[model samples]
Target: MHTAKILIAYDGSDNARRAVSYTAAMVGSGGNRLVDVAAIERPADRDLFADDAAWKAECARRIEAMRTSLNEARAMLVAAGVPEAAVTTRFVESCRSPLREAQECSIGTSIALEILRLAEEGGYDTVVVGRRGVSKQEEFLFGSVSTKIIHAAKGLAVWVVA
Candidate 1:
Protein backbone atom coordinates (compact mmCIF):
# COMPACT_ATOMS: atom_id res chain seq x y z
CA MET A 1 0.00 0.00 0.00
CA HIS A 2 1.16 3.49 -0.66
CA THR A 3 1.81 5.68 2.35
CA ALA A 4 -0.51 8.67 2.47
CA LYS A 5 0.82 12.08 3.43
CA ILE A 6 -1.95 14.33 4.73
CA LEU A 7 -1.68 18.01 5.61
CA ILE A 8 -4.31 19.63 7.80
CA ALA A 9 -4.69 23.39 8.25
CA TYR A 10 -5.77 24.15 11.79
CA ASP A 11 -6.68 27.42 13.48
CA GLY A 12 -8.35 26.16 16.71
CA SER A 13 -11.70 27.24 15.35
CA ASP A 14 -14.80 25.03 15.51
CA ASN A 15 -14.71 24.24 11.81
CA ALA A 16 -10.98 23.66 11.82
CA ARG A 17 -11.41 21.25 14.71
CA ARG A 18 -14.05 19.50 12.65
CA ALA A 19 -11.64 19.23 9.75
CA VAL A 20 -9.06 17.59 12.02
CA SER A 21 -11.70 15.16 13.20
CA TYR A 22 -12.71 14.41 9.65
CA THR A 23 -9.12 13.78 8.65
CA ALA A 24 -8.61 11.46 11.60
CA ALA A 25 -11.67 9.52 10.62
CA MET A 26 -10.58 9.24 7.03
CA VAL A 27 -6.95 8.39 7.85
CA GLY A 28 -7.78 5.99 10.68
CA SER A 29 -5.02 4.35 12.75
CA GLY A 30 -3.06 3.03 9.84
CA GLY A 31 0.69 3.16 10.13
CA ASN A 32 0.84 3.90 6.43
CA ARG A 33 -0.53 7.39 7.03
CA LEU A 34 1.40 10.49 8.01
CA VAL A 35 -0.48 13.52 9.29
CA ASP A 36 0.75 17.05 9.67
CA VAL A 37 -1.33 19.71 11.43
CA ALA A 38 -0.20 23.20 10.55
CA ALA A 39 -1.37 26.69 11.40
CA ILE A 40 -0.49 29.75 9.33
CA GLU A 41 0.11 32.87 11.31
CA ARG A 42 0.15 36.28 9.68
CA PRO A 43 3.21 38.31 10.52
CA ALA A 44 2.81 41.49 12.52
CA ASP A 45 3.21 44.47 10.22
CA ARG A 46 6.27 46.51 11.17
CA ASP A 47 4.32 49.75 10.89
CA LEU A 48 1.83 48.61 13.50
CA PHE A 49 4.40 48.41 16.24
CA ALA A 50 5.86 51.44 17.95
CA ASP A 51 9.39 49.99 18.26
CA ASP A 52 11.50 47.13 16.98
CA ALA A 53 11.42 45.44 20.38
CA ALA A 54 7.65 45.62 20.50
CA TRP A 55 7.36 44.26 16.98
CA LYS A 56 9.58 41.30 17.87
CA ALA A 57 7.54 40.65 21.00
CA GLU A 58 4.27 40.69 19.05
CA CYS A 59 5.69 38.29 16.51
CA ALA A 60 6.80 35.95 19.26
CA ARG A 61 3.38 36.08 20.84
CA ARG A 62 1.63 35.23 17.55
CA ILE A 63 3.89 32.25 16.98
CA GLU A 64 3.28 31.03 20.52
CA ALA A 65 -0.45 31.28 19.96
CA MET A 66 -0.15 29.23 16.79
CA ARG A 67 1.92 26.66 18.69
CA THR A 68 -0.87 26.33 21.20
CA SER A 69 -3.40 25.84 18.41
CA LEU A 70 -1.20 23.24 16.75
CA ASN A 71 -0.92 21.37 20.04
CA GLU A 72 -4.66 21.17 20.26
CA ALA A 73 -4.91 19.78 16.75
CA ARG A 74 -2.25 17.18 17.53
CA ALA A 75 -4.16 16.08 20.59
CA MET A 76 -7.30 15.69 18.53
CA LEU A 77 -5.60 13.48 15.99
CA VAL A 78 -3.99 11.36 18.68
CA ALA A 79 -7.27 10.94 20.47
CA ALA A 80 -8.78 9.70 17.25
CA GLY A 81 -6.20 6.87 17.15
CA VAL A 82 -3.53 8.33 14.90
CA PRO A 83 -0.16 7.31 16.36
CA GLU A 84 1.77 9.99 18.15
CA ALA A 85 4.83 9.20 16.07
CA ALA A 86 2.86 9.41 12.83
CA VAL A 87 1.60 12.94 13.46
CA THR A 88 3.44 16.27 13.61
CA THR A 89 2.58 19.94 14.03
CA ARG A 90 3.98 23.18 12.68
CA PHE A 91 3.21 26.88 12.29
CA VAL A 92 4.40 29.09 9.44
CA GLU A 93 4.32 32.79 8.75
CA SER A 94 1.94 33.67 5.91
CA CYS A 95 3.53 36.75 4.44
CA ARG A 96 4.69 35.48 1.09
CA SER A 97 3.48 35.99 -2.45
CA PRO A 98 4.71 34.89 -5.83
CA LEU A 99 4.58 38.51 -6.90
CA ARG A 100 7.25 40.71 -5.36
CA GLU A 101 4.83 43.56 -4.80
CA ALA A 102 2.30 41.33 -3.06
CA GLN A 103 4.83 39.70 -0.71
CA GLU A 104 4.23 42.25 2.01
CA CYS A 105 0.44 42.07 1.75
CA SER A 106 -0.95 39.60 4.27
CA ILE A 107 -4.61 40.48 4.48
CA GLY A 108 -6.42 38.23 2.00
CA THR A 109 -3.92 35.39 2.00
CA SER A 110 -4.28 34.10 5.48
CA ILE A 111 -3.42 30.39 5.51
CA ALA A 112 -4.22 29.24 1.98
CA LEU A 113 -0.99 30.09 0.19
CA GLU A 114 1.19 28.82 3.00
CA ILE A 115 -0.80 25.60 3.11
CA LEU A 116 -0.39 25.15 -0.61
CA ARG A 117 3.33 25.90 -0.36
CA LEU A 118 3.78 23.34 2.39
CA ALA A 119 1.73 20.72 0.56
CA GLU A 120 3.82 21.01 -2.56
CA GLU A 121 7.15 21.33 -0.76
CA GLY A 122 6.36 18.37 1.49
CA GLY A 123 4.83 16.29 -1.31
CA TYR A 124 1.61 15.83 0.55
CA ASP A 125 -1.08 13.78 -1.13
CA THR A 126 -4.00 15.62 0.42
CA VAL A 127 -4.80 18.94 2.10
CA VAL A 128 -7.64 19.37 4.61
CA VAL A 129 -9.09 22.53 6.08
CA GLY A 130 -12.25 24.04 7.51
CA ARG A 131 -14.98 25.37 5.28
CA ARG A 132 -14.76 28.59 7.28
CA GLY A 133 -12.78 29.81 10.23
CA VAL A 134 -13.36 31.96 13.32
CA SER A 135 -13.58 35.28 11.58
CA LYS A 136 -16.64 35.77 9.42
CA GLN A 137 -15.77 39.43 9.19
CA GLU A 138 -12.35 38.65 7.87
CA GLU A 139 -13.79 36.19 5.39
CA PHE A 140 -16.14 38.82 4.15
CA LEU A 141 -13.33 41.31 3.88
CA PHE A 142 -10.53 39.09 2.52
CA GLY A 143 -12.28 36.07 1.04
CA SER A 144 -12.15 32.58 2.52
CA VAL A 145 -8.87 30.71 2.88
CA SER A 146 -10.49 27.39 2.11
CA THR A 147 -12.01 28.87 -1.02
CA LYS A 148 -8.65 30.19 -2.10
CA ILE A 149 -6.99 26.85 -1.41
CA ILE A 150 -9.69 25.05 -3.36
CA HIS A 151 -9.23 27.31 -6.36
CA ALA A 152 -5.43 27.34 -6.18
CA ALA A 153 -4.53 23.74 -5.37
CA LYS A 154 -3.90 21.50 -8.35
CA GLY A 155 -3.12 17.80 -8.67
CA LEU A 156 -3.83 17.32 -4.97
CA ALA A 157 -6.90 16.32 -3.00
CA VAL A 158 -8.45 18.95 -0.75
CA TRP A 159 -11.04 18.43 1.99
CA VAL A 160 -12.91 21.37 3.46
CA VAL A 161 -14.77 20.14 6.52
CA ALA A 162 -17.74 22.18 7.66
Candidate 2:
Protein backbone atom coordinates (compact mmCIF):
# COMPACT_ATOMS: atom_id res chain seq x y z
CA MET A 1 0.00 0.00 0.00
CA HIS A 2 1.20 3.50 -0.76
CA THR A 3 1.54 5.81 2.22
CA ALA A 4 -0.32 9.06 1.76
CA LYS A 5 1.47 12.38 2.07
CA ILE A 6 -0.97 15.20 2.82
CA LEU A 7 -0.20 18.87 3.07
CA ILE A 8 -2.59 21.15 4.94
CA ALA A 9 -2.16 24.88 4.47
CA TYR A 10 -2.97 26.54 7.77
CA ASP A 11 -3.46 30.01 9.19
CA GLY A 12 -5.30 31.23 12.28
CA SER A 13 -8.74 31.29 10.76
CA ASP A 14 -12.03 29.37 10.99
CA ASN A 15 -11.60 28.10 7.43
CA ALA A 16 -8.11 26.85 8.15
CA ARG A 17 -9.23 25.15 11.34
CA ARG A 18 -11.95 23.39 9.40
CA ALA A 19 -9.34 22.14 6.95
CA VAL A 20 -7.42 20.67 9.84
CA SER A 21 -10.48 18.88 11.11
CA TYR A 22 -11.15 17.51 7.66
CA THR A 23 -7.57 16.25 7.35
CA ALA A 24 -7.72 14.61 10.75
CA ALA A 25 -10.83 12.74 9.79
CA MET A 26 -9.27 11.54 6.55
CA VAL A 27 -6.03 10.36 8.19
CA GLY A 28 -7.19 9.15 11.60
CA SER A 29 -8.50 5.84 10.33
CA GLY A 30 -5.67 5.18 7.94
CA GLY A 31 -2.33 3.50 8.41
CA ASN A 32 1.07 4.59 7.13
CA ARG A 33 -0.03 8.15 6.49
CA LEU A 34 1.38 11.57 7.41
CA VAL A 35 0.28 15.17 7.11
CA ASP A 36 2.34 18.30 6.59
CA VAL A 37 0.90 21.52 8.00
CA ALA A 38 2.31 24.71 6.52
CA ALA A 39 1.52 28.39 6.91
CA ILE A 40 2.94 31.16 4.73
CA GLU A 41 2.81 34.54 6.44
CA ARG A 42 2.40 37.63 4.29
CA PRO A 43 4.52 40.59 5.32
CA ALA A 44 2.90 43.72 6.71
CA ASP A 45 2.20 46.23 3.99
CA ARG A 46 4.68 49.02 4.48
CA ASP A 47 3.51 52.37 5.80
CA LEU A 48 4.86 55.87 5.47
CA PHE A 49 5.46 56.14 9.22
CA ALA A 50 6.60 52.57 9.89
CA ASP A 51 10.29 52.01 9.15
CA ASP A 52 12.10 48.76 8.36
CA ALA A 53 12.47 47.83 12.02
CA ALA A 54 8.80 48.32 12.68
CA TRP A 55 7.82 46.26 9.65
CA LYS A 56 10.11 43.40 10.62
CA ALA A 57 8.76 43.50 14.16
CA GLU A 58 5.22 43.35 12.87
CA CYS A 59 6.03 40.35 10.70
CA ALA A 60 7.60 38.64 13.71
CA ARG A 61 4.42 39.16 15.70
CA ARG A 62 2.36 37.75 12.87
CA ILE A 63 4.56 34.67 12.69
CA GLU A 64 4.30 34.22 16.45
CA ALA A 65 0.55 34.34 16.27
CA MET A 66 0.65 31.74 13.51
CA ARG A 67 2.77 29.53 15.73
CA THR A 68 -0.10 29.26 18.17
CA SER A 69 -2.42 28.19 15.40
CA LEU A 70 0.13 25.67 14.13
CA ASN A 71 0.34 24.19 17.59
CA GLU A 72 -3.42 23.84 17.76
CA ALA A 73 -3.45 22.11 14.39
CA ARG A 74 -0.75 19.70 15.49
CA ALA A 75 -2.59 18.95 18.71
CA MET A 76 -5.82 18.31 16.89
CA LEU A 77 -4.13 15.95 14.45
CA VAL A 78 -2.50 13.99 17.23
CA ALA A 79 -5.72 13.73 19.17
CA ALA A 80 -7.41 12.26 16.15
CA GLY A 81 -4.94 9.30 16.19
CA VAL A 82 -2.09 10.50 13.95
CA PRO A 83 1.26 10.05 15.62
CA GLU A 84 3.03 13.18 16.76
CA ALA A 85 5.99 12.43 14.55
CA ALA A 86 3.77 12.08 11.52
CA VAL A 87 2.62 15.70 11.71
CA THR A 88 5.13 18.29 10.53
CA THR A 89 4.50 22.01 10.93
CA ARG A 90 6.28 24.63 8.86
CA PHE A 91 6.22 28.39 8.24
CA VAL A 92 7.45 30.39 5.28
CA GLU A 93 7.61 34.05 4.38
CA SER A 94 5.67 35.09 1.35
CA CYS A 95 7.82 36.27 -1.49
CA ARG A 96 8.41 40.00 -1.67
CA SER A 97 7.44 41.44 -5.01
CA PRO A 98 8.91 44.68 -6.21
CA LEU A 99 6.47 47.54 -6.58
CA ARG A 100 5.53 49.15 -9.91
CA GLU A 101 6.73 46.10 -11.79
CA ALA A 102 4.67 44.55 -14.55
CA GLN A 103 5.50 41.05 -13.23
CA GLU A 104 4.61 41.86 -9.65
CA CYS A 105 2.55 39.36 -7.65
CA SER A 106 0.37 39.55 -4.59
CA ILE A 107 1.33 37.82 -1.37
CA GLY A 108 -1.42 35.24 -1.82
CA THR A 109 -0.10 34.39 -5.27
CA SER A 110 3.36 33.94 -3.87
CA ILE A 111 2.01 31.73 -1.11
CA ALA A 112 0.15 29.56 -3.58
CA LEU A 113 3.32 29.15 -5.61
CA GLU A 114 5.25 28.20 -2.51
CA ILE A 115 2.71 25.54 -1.60
CA LEU A 116 2.95 24.02 -5.06
CA ARG A 117 6.73 24.05 -4.91
CA LEU A 118 6.73 22.19 -1.62
CA ALA A 119 4.19 19.70 -2.85
CA GLU A 120 6.25 18.83 -5.92
CA GLU A 121 9.58 18.65 -4.12
CA GLY A 122 8.25 16.85 -1.07
CA GLY A 123 6.35 14.35 -3.23
CA TYR A 124 3.07 15.05 -1.51
CA ASP A 125 0.20 13.26 -3.20
CA THR A 126 -2.51 15.68 -2.24
CA VAL A 127 -2.50 19.30 -1.14
CA VAL A 128 -5.38 20.12 1.16
CA VAL A 129 -6.29 23.72 1.83
CA GLY A 130 -9.04 25.98 3.08
CA ARG A 131 -11.44 27.34 0.51
CA ARG A 132 -11.36 30.74 2.19
CA GLY A 133 -9.35 32.21 5.02
CA VAL A 134 -9.65 34.89 7.72
CA SER A 135 -10.23 37.94 5.60
CA LYS A 136 -13.64 37.85 4.02
CA GLN A 137 -13.27 41.42 2.88
CA GLU A 138 -10.05 40.70 1.03
CA GLU A 139 -11.49 37.57 -0.49
CA PHE A 140 -14.56 39.46 -1.57
CA LEU A 141 -12.43 42.01 -3.33
CA PHE A 142 -9.55 39.84 -4.57
CA GLY A 143 -10.66 36.23 -4.30
CA SER A 144 -9.15 33.57 -2.00
CA VAL A 145 -5.84 31.76 -1.83
CA SER A 146 -7.45 28.43 -2.57
CA THR A 147 -8.63 29.69 -5.91
CA LYS A 148 -5.11 30.72 -6.83
CA ILE A 149 -3.70 27.39 -5.69
CA ILE A 150 -6.30 25.50 -7.64
CA HIS A 151 -5.22 27.20 -10.84
CA ALA A 152 -1.49 26.93 -10.19
CA ALA A 153 -1.18 23.45 -8.71
CA LYS A 154 -1.17 21.37 -11.85
CA GLY A 155 -0.60 17.58 -12.06
CA LEU A 156 -1.63 17.24 -8.42
CA ALA A 157 -4.79 16.67 -6.48
CA VAL A 158 -6.07 19.57 -4.39
CA TRP A 159 -8.71 19.05 -1.75
CA VAL A 160 -10.21 22.28 -0.54
CA VAL A 161 -12.48 22.28 2.48
CA ALA A 162 -15.14 24.90 3.11
Candidate 3:
Protein backbone atom coordinates (compact mmCIF):
# COMPACT_ATOMS: atom_id res chain seq x y z
CA MET A 1 0.00 0.00 0.00
CA HIS A 2 1.18 3.53 -0.65
CA THR A 3 2.03 5.67 2.33
CA ALA A 4 -0.72 8.15 3.08
CA LYS A 5 -0.01 11.85 3.37
CA ILE A 6 -2.31 13.26 6.06
CA LEU A 7 -3.00 16.84 7.02
CA ILE A 8 -4.58 17.67 10.38
CA ALA A 9 -6.51 20.85 11.05
CA TYR A 10 -5.65 21.65 14.62
CA ASP A 11 -7.01 24.44 16.82
CA GLY A 12 -5.94 23.38 20.32
CA SER A 13 -9.48 22.31 21.18
CA ASP A 14 -10.07 18.98 22.89
CA ASN A 15 -11.77 17.77 19.75
CA ALA A 16 -8.80 18.90 17.68
CA ARG A 17 -6.48 17.06 20.01
CA ARG A 18 -8.61 13.99 19.62
CA ALA A 19 -8.39 14.32 15.85
CA VAL A 20 -4.59 14.32 16.01
CA SER A 21 -4.57 11.42 18.42
CA TYR A 22 -6.92 9.47 16.18
CA THR A 23 -4.89 10.17 13.06
CA ALA A 24 -1.69 9.24 14.80
CA ALA A 25 -3.17 5.89 15.68
CA MET A 26 -4.45 5.30 12.17
CA VAL A 27 -1.16 6.15 10.46
CA GLY A 28 1.04 4.34 13.01
CA SER A 29 4.84 4.69 12.99
CA GLY A 30 5.45 3.94 9.37
CA GLY A 31 8.53 5.58 7.99
CA ASN A 32 6.77 6.29 4.73
CA ARG A 33 3.81 8.01 6.35
CA LEU A 34 3.94 11.79 6.48
CA VAL A 35 1.79 13.89 8.83
CA ASP A 36 1.25 17.60 8.63
CA VAL A 37 -0.44 19.55 11.42
CA ALA A 38 -1.74 23.01 10.69
CA ALA A 39 -3.32 25.68 12.84
CA ILE A 40 -5.38 28.32 11.09
CA GLU A 41 -6.34 31.75 12.30
CA ARG A 42 -8.81 33.99 10.50
CA PRO A 43 -8.22 37.44 11.78
CA ALA A 44 -11.33 38.93 13.32
CA ASP A 45 -12.67 42.17 11.96
CA ARG A 46 -10.93 45.22 13.37
CA ASP A 47 -14.27 46.67 14.38
CA LEU A 48 -14.87 43.68 16.61
CA PHE A 49 -11.78 44.40 18.70
CA ALA A 50 -12.29 48.08 19.44
CA ASP A 51 -9.03 49.99 18.75
CA ASP A 52 -6.17 49.33 16.34
CA ALA A 53 -3.86 48.43 19.19
CA ALA A 54 -6.40 45.97 20.47
CA TRP A 55 -6.81 44.46 17.00
CA LYS A 56 -3.04 44.02 16.68
CA ALA A 57 -2.91 42.44 20.12
CA GLU A 58 -5.68 40.06 19.15
CA CYS A 59 -3.82 39.05 16.05
CA ALA A 60 -0.66 38.43 18.04
CA ARG A 61 -2.55 36.35 20.53
CA ARG A 62 -4.16 34.31 17.77
CA ILE A 63 -0.80 33.69 16.14
CA GLU A 64 0.66 32.53 19.42
CA ALA A 65 -2.33 30.29 19.96
CA MET A 66 -1.92 28.78 16.50
CA ARG A 67 1.76 28.06 17.20
CA THR A 68 0.83 26.37 20.43
CA SER A 69 -1.81 24.28 18.66
CA LEU A 70 0.68 23.10 16.03
CA ASN A 71 3.20 22.16 18.70
CA GLU A 72 0.58 20.26 20.63
CA ALA A 73 -0.59 18.37 17.55
CA ARG A 74 2.98 17.42 16.64
CA ALA A 75 3.62 16.16 20.14
CA MET A 76 0.42 14.14 20.07
CA LEU A 77 1.39 12.54 16.79
CA VAL A 78 4.82 11.66 18.18
CA ALA A 79 3.26 10.13 21.25
CA ALA A 80 0.62 8.26 19.32
CA GLY A 81 3.11 6.22 17.24
CA VAL A 82 4.08 8.42 14.32
CA PRO A 83 7.81 9.06 13.97
CA GLU A 84 8.83 12.56 15.05
CA ALA A 85 10.68 13.08 11.79
CA ALA A 86 7.58 12.28 9.75
CA VAL A 87 5.57 15.06 11.35
CA THR A 88 5.55 18.66 10.13
CA THR A 89 3.67 21.74 11.34
CA ARG A 90 2.20 24.86 9.76
CA PHE A 91 0.34 28.04 10.74
CA VAL A 92 -1.98 29.87 8.40
CA GLU A 93 -3.82 33.16 8.71
CA SER A 94 -6.49 34.66 6.50
CA CYS A 95 -8.98 37.44 6.55
CA ARG A 96 -12.19 35.87 7.90
CA SER A 97 -14.59 37.36 5.38
CA PRO A 98 -13.33 36.45 1.93
CA LEU A 99 -13.78 32.73 2.40
CA ARG A 100 -17.44 31.99 1.70
CA GLU A 101 -19.24 30.37 4.58
CA ALA A 102 -20.66 27.00 3.64
CA GLN A 103 -24.34 27.77 3.78
CA GLU A 104 -25.53 24.73 1.94
CA CYS A 105 -24.98 21.96 4.44
CA SER A 106 -23.20 23.68 7.30
CA ILE A 107 -23.37 26.74 9.50
CA GLY A 108 -20.62 29.29 10.02
CA THR A 109 -18.29 26.75 8.49
CA SER A 110 -16.41 29.06 6.22
CA ILE A 111 -13.02 27.67 7.22
CA ALA A 112 -13.41 24.53 5.12
CA LEU A 113 -12.33 26.36 1.94
CA GLU A 114 -8.96 27.16 3.46
CA ILE A 115 -8.54 23.60 4.66
CA LEU A 116 -9.32 22.39 1.17
CA ARG A 117 -6.73 24.72 -0.30
CA LEU A 118 -4.08 23.46 2.07
CA ALA A 119 -4.90 19.80 1.53
CA GLU A 120 -4.77 20.10 -2.26
CA GLU A 121 -1.68 22.30 -2.35
CA GLY A 122 0.19 20.16 0.17
CA GLY A 123 -0.58 16.93 -1.71
CA TYR A 124 -2.28 15.36 1.24
CA ASP A 125 -4.53 12.38 0.69
CA THR A 126 -6.45 12.76 3.91
CA VAL A 127 -7.59 15.70 5.99
CA VAL A 128 -8.49 15.34 9.67
CA VAL A 129 -10.36 17.80 11.79
CA GLY A 130 -12.60 17.88 14.84
CA ARG A 131 -16.35 17.56 14.66
CA ARG A 132 -16.70 20.80 16.51
CA GLY A 133 -14.00 23.21 17.68
CA VAL A 134 -15.98 25.61 19.77
CA SER A 135 -17.98 25.53 22.97
CA LYS A 136 -21.54 24.23 23.10
CA GLN A 137 -23.07 27.62 22.71
CA GLU A 138 -20.79 28.57 19.87
CA GLU A 139 -21.33 25.32 18.08
CA PHE A 140 -25.04 25.57 18.54
CA LEU A 141 -24.99 29.00 16.99
CA PHE A 142 -22.35 28.42 14.31
CA GLY A 143 -22.76 24.78 13.27
CA SER A 144 -19.80 22.48 12.50
CA VAL A 145 -16.74 22.80 10.27
CA SER A 146 -16.59 19.06 9.77
CA THR A 147 -19.79 19.03 7.77
CA LYS A 148 -18.49 21.64 5.42
CA ILE A 149 -15.20 19.88 4.97
CA ILE A 150 -16.93 16.64 4.10
CA HIS A 151 -18.86 18.39 1.40
CA ALA A 152 -15.89 20.38 0.09
CA ALA A 153 -13.18 17.71 -0.06
CA LYS A 154 -14.69 15.94 -3.08
CA GLY A 155 -12.01 13.41 -3.99
CA LEU A 156 -9.97 13.45 -0.79
CA ALA A 157 -10.69 11.49 2.36
CA VAL A 158 -11.74 13.54 5.35
CA TRP A 159 -11.87 12.24 8.89
CA VAL A 160 -13.95 14.12 11.39
CA VAL A 161 -12.68 13.16 14.83
CA ALA A 162 -15.11 13.49 17.69
Error of 3 at 143 (Å): 3.8
Per-prediction TM-score to the true structure, in the order listed: 0.78, 0.81, 0.81
Better of 2 and 3 by lDDT: 2
Tens-digit lDDT string for candidate 2 (1-162): 888899998877888899999999988956998899988767677673257777767766776798888999999999999999899998765555222232423355567777888899899989998876448688778767798889888877899998
Each prediction's number of clashing residue pairs: 0, 0, 0
Per-residue error for 88 in candidate 1, Å, reads 1.2
Report the lDDT tens digits of candidate 3 across residue range 20-117. 88988888875588999876666657688667787777767776777877887888888888888899997665544333233322122366777788
- Give candidate 1's whole-model lDDT: 0.80
Error of 1 at 2 (Å): 0.2
Write down the lDDT that model 2 would get: 0.80
Which runs of model 1 end up more than 4 angstroms from their true locations? 93-110, 133-140
Clash tally for model 1: 0
Ranked candidates (TM-score, high to low) = 2, 3, 1
- In the range 65-144, model 1's lDDT, one tens digit per residue, is 77788888899889889999999997655453122132333343446887888899899999998986548778778788
lDDT of 1 at 31: 65
